[model samples]
Target: MKFLHIADLHIGKRVNEFNMIEDQKYILEQLISVIESEKPKGIIIAGDVYDKSQPSGEAVELFDDFLTKLVSLAEFVFIISGNHDSPERLSFGSRILKKSGLYIAGVFDGKMNKITLKDEYGPLHVYLLPFVKPAVVRAYYDEEIESYNDAVNVIISNEKISMDERNILVAHQFVTSGGVSPERSDSENISLGGLDNVDASLFRNFDYVALGHIHRPQKIGRDEIRYAGSPLKYSFSEARHHKSVTVLEIKEKGNVKIDLIPLLPLRDLREIKGPINELIKIGKEDYKGSTDYIHATITDEDEIYDALGKLRQVYPNIMILDFDNKRSRSNISFEELSSEKIESKSPLDLFEEFYEAQNNKKLSEEEIKIIERLLEKAGGIEI
Candidate 1:
């Protein structure tokens, strides 16, 4: 069986405060082209389908177009809801949608909704697992589970089939050693010690594990488990990633052949740092490829009051700016600030001995009051 794997499309993403509606439309068209050219039997989108829980109409249409395209050539398509998705909204017409070769799981009903597809080599059974937090799982079971680990274990253990089936598991959540992007999680997801991290050992029973939530395509511990990454560069941190979708070909004998199909983005993301003069060398073009989104940092000796204005004349789509100062800034070093000795007699404790030798033991009323105020404001420095 041959299938395509993609995730974190983030269809409603607002890139650099500009509407990416056209860009998203182009990508959805590209995905259709891939499906028609490759003729994959099925496709799997792990999670984070939309940028917002309540997505805009444009985002909904973009998603509809992509799904409508895939169902034309693909025999089966599997999708799960992520933390960013409103499950009820995404899973609209779940019963009817599944009949059109799409299987979606937004609610954890404690049952595996397995979709079976046929190829020359028997059948492939794919199990869809959506994003579920510890609290949600506990509520589903009506029991108190200690952590997400317990909830995950319970969900996996309850599967009523053997591990040896032609099975695939799809999930969306953080796992150890995964890469993240800034475009996702608008300040809420970055809490509680980044505890969303899960271990790779959870999928030991499955034939292959398709994962998501990490925006950079990578293999977790082994090739059998992997993330296809996002379709486009979603944030500043994802500037260095070469976005891709994966194609997996599996045979009846449990032989797997996975191919990385790289997606060339409509506009590249670039970060450039240098002085204004060097940055705008009129004679040459350095960032010719990244004409869409560029973040520039000016390390100038003097402030160019309208640096952004000047840069806009050169690169019209410039999105970010920063001024870096590497000189004329003095502060105590870390060693100096943190090092204080109290094991021996402190200077204040042995004031009389130190005063006799150096003749500088005490401060005047003005100096003493200033020191007292500084200490009080500094939270009364430790010791």
Candidate 2:
């Protein structure tokens, strides 16, 4: 059995305040075209179908259209909701869709969904465990779920899966092996520290583990366990990532071959570090791909007049601008800065620091007010 592994579509996502709907549409079309050529038996969408839990109307339409086309290309399709999705909403008509060769696994109601496919060899079980939290699992199982590994192990143990046969597990979590986490991008909204880490050893029984949550495509511990990565470069931090879809060919139990089909984006994300004047003088012939989205780091010792304006004259889609002079580099380390800020900063300042780290810019006054209201509601703190 052959299948296409993809994840983290993040439709309706915005980068540097620019909407990516058109770019997403273009990439999805390319994906569908590839699907038509490869003609895999099925497609496994690990998680993070949309950018937000309550996706916008346009996002809903975009996903709906994609699914409509996908079901026509592949016979069996499996999808699970990620932390960014509302499970109930994603699985609204899951029962009805399953009849049409689409299996949707959203909420975890104390059980994991398993669908068995077959070839000439034997049965191939495909287990779907959507993005899970310790608290959610504890509520259902009523057990001591102290860590992510514990939660997952307990859930799979209840399923009574036979390890003798070939099994493919689809999961979305921060999977780590020997204290080493997978590569992360700025677009992924993960918890700080190691609160969400799940040991990869918990999934040793499975033949191929299709993982999500991390945007950089890589194998964890072994080649069989992999992250397909996002179809596009969502952040400047992922500028070096060669985005692709993982194609798996499972001939028999414990016998699998993997291939990564590269995905080329409509506009690439690029970073250039130099003086503003040098960047402005870059001719079209000198830089063939100047139209790509740019993150420029100006290295001039003194501040140039309207530096961004000058660079924009040459590169229209400049997304990020920063100074990399002596003054900028002579800053304290992140550990020291975070420690001092925690001791001296107010709640708002702390929140702004976190926001700026996730996003590349500080929150606006309106956005800050929204955060204040949410904090007040969650913790009953008067800000």
Candidate 3:
């Protein structure tokens, strides 16, 4: 039994802060081509099937077409919803879809519903673990599950899984110190301490563990337990990482072999850092593939006028711009800055505190009122 592993598809994703619909279409086409050529027995989409809870019509259509192609092979397809997905929307008609070899695990109903797929040798049991909040999981199980780690353990322990079966577990969440991409920073709500950590031993009994939530594809601890990253470059930070899916060949129940198939991009991700004159003159240099997607940082004393237009000739997908050289250079430590504890008080009390702290200059009535509203929205009293 062989299968293709892909995740964080984010089908309706409008990345780089730009609505690049055409680029998305091109990448999806490339992915379909891979499926056609590989012809795996099953395909596992780890999580984040769609970019939004209410995805646009085009996104739904694109996903439907993609599934239609996959359905032709009638391969076992397993999916789980991420934080971005609306469980109700994603799981709609999921039961019926399962009849066609498709399974969507959205809501955490406290049952480890295994989609058993029979191969030439024996049965393969795959567990679909969708993104779940600790509160929800605790309520469903009727327990005090304070953290994601706690909730997962409770689920695993209570799940009616057989030790005799060859199991596969799929999950989506931050696995303690797993790789973080800039794209994820925007989409994922960072629940660092309590909600972030999950032990790899949770899936010890499984033959293979397919993971999601992390954008850059990488093996967490080893090759067997891995993340088949997003199909396309979702962030400038992921500029250097090669996006790809993992193809697994399981000849027997417990044995597994893995292969990483590199994905082709409509525009490659790239970053360049230098002075204004140097970046402007990058076209003159022998930069071959840098034109695809560019994140240029100008390290100059002054802002370069129309910097993007100048670089667009050589780099078409230049979406982000930064000025490390020209902008304010403060070397203050984040830890120290964030550690300053302020007291919750009235608007006037807040003004007195900030006024004395910044420059020992007191604020006027009008200034105080304006600053009060701003700080109120920014959680000034919540210090």
Model 1, position 22, has a per-residue lDDT of: 74
Backbone atom clashes (below 3 Å) for every candidate:
0, 0, 0
lDDT of 3 by residue, 149-242 (tens): 7888888888777777678888887764343322343344566545566767666777888988878878766567887888887777677778
For each candidate, the alpha-carbon lDDT, in order, equals: 0.74, 0.88, 0.76
- Winning candidate number (lDDT): 2
How do these models rank on lDDT, best leading? 2, 3, 1
Clashing pairs in 1: none
**In model 3, which residue pairs have backbone atoms overlapping below 3 Å?**
none
What's the true lDDT of residue 303 in model 3? 51
- Comparing 1 and 2 on lDDT, the stronger one: 2
TM-score of each: 0.80, 0.84, 0.79
